[model samples]
Target: MNRRLFLAAFPAVLAAGCGFKLRRFEDIPFASLYIDAPHGGAVAQRIRSALTSSKQTRLAASAGEAEAVLVLGPEARSKVILSLSGAGRVTEYRLGLQLTYRISDKDGRTLAAAEVIELSRDITYDDTQVLAKAAEEQLLYRDMEDSAARRIMRRLQSIGPGPAS
Candidate 1:
């Protein structure tokens, strides 16, 4: 029994000795940030929720009050048929979500250039389950939106303080 316990503890001890640490959210460089996106937009809401949870930066009420402004451009969603059944009915669909964004200082100096993040997922569909498939489609889009928000957060984390012009 003691031997088994020693064996089980060895890996943990080794990891600790090697300074291994779990990956976690990093701190944002800006003290306060303003997200310029539609208030009711799903992706924007997700990003706001993530920023709030991080506690690294405060959300500014307006662009003028922020140290940096995050401008979110138009978001686009698309669904295209990737495959079809013998009867010409839809068999599979490729769903895509694209968002454009940039980061700038209150003085309008670009901290990060404009970039686009695009995500896509494929789902098999059945005509017999129209309602169920529709629900699943919505779920997939929600997942994609959440993913985009996380990606944006990661990008934000990578940005360092730029010279104020």
Candidate 2:
């Protein structure tokens, strides 16, 4: 291409690049969200806490008036990996949590589904270190759930029946 044509096209390309935009949080009318999960386990608590901490949606007490319901299926699995010692005996353990989640509207229409959000961390053999590692893993799982919530929000905003800006 000639320099003149290149320069003329370059401005259009830049304009096109800068024209791309994503819907902001205010564009969605999701005032609050209801999260359904048993609270006895750490993973469940993490899931609840993640939703509550989200900037996108306020945490609601129930699904009655919520714009969305985050239903946590179950504490699917807690996988334990036994690392072998030099003599082939168990030396250390790594624990992992896998969770499935789905978001639905107040009318029970499915909005978005995430089958698995897996989080894990390794722990030493010592009891004290094990407790610390467990806490760290819990935090990691919370972070994973938070990321999943953000993804759900983006999906919902993209494909939902909510009013567009």
TM-score to true structure, per model:
0.83, 0.55
Poorly placed runs, candidate 1 (over 4 Å) = 1-24
**Among all candidates shown, the one with the greatest TM-score:** 1
lDDT of 1 by residue, 120-141 (tens): 9999999899999999999999
lDDT of 2 by residue, 1-165 (tens): 699999999988987889865533333446777878766644446545554555666777789878878787666445465687676655576666666777778888777755566666565554447677667666665565555555545555665543332
Residue 153 of model 2 has an lDDT of 50
Candidates in order have lDDT scores of 0.89, 0.63
Q: What CA RMSD would you report for each candidate?
A: 2.7, 8.5
Question: How does candidate 2 score on lDDT?
Answer: 0.63
Clashing pairs in 2: none
**What 10-residue stretch in candidate 1 is worst by lDDT?**
156-165
Candidate 2 runs further than 4 Å off? 1-29, 41-44, 47-56, 76-79, 124-165
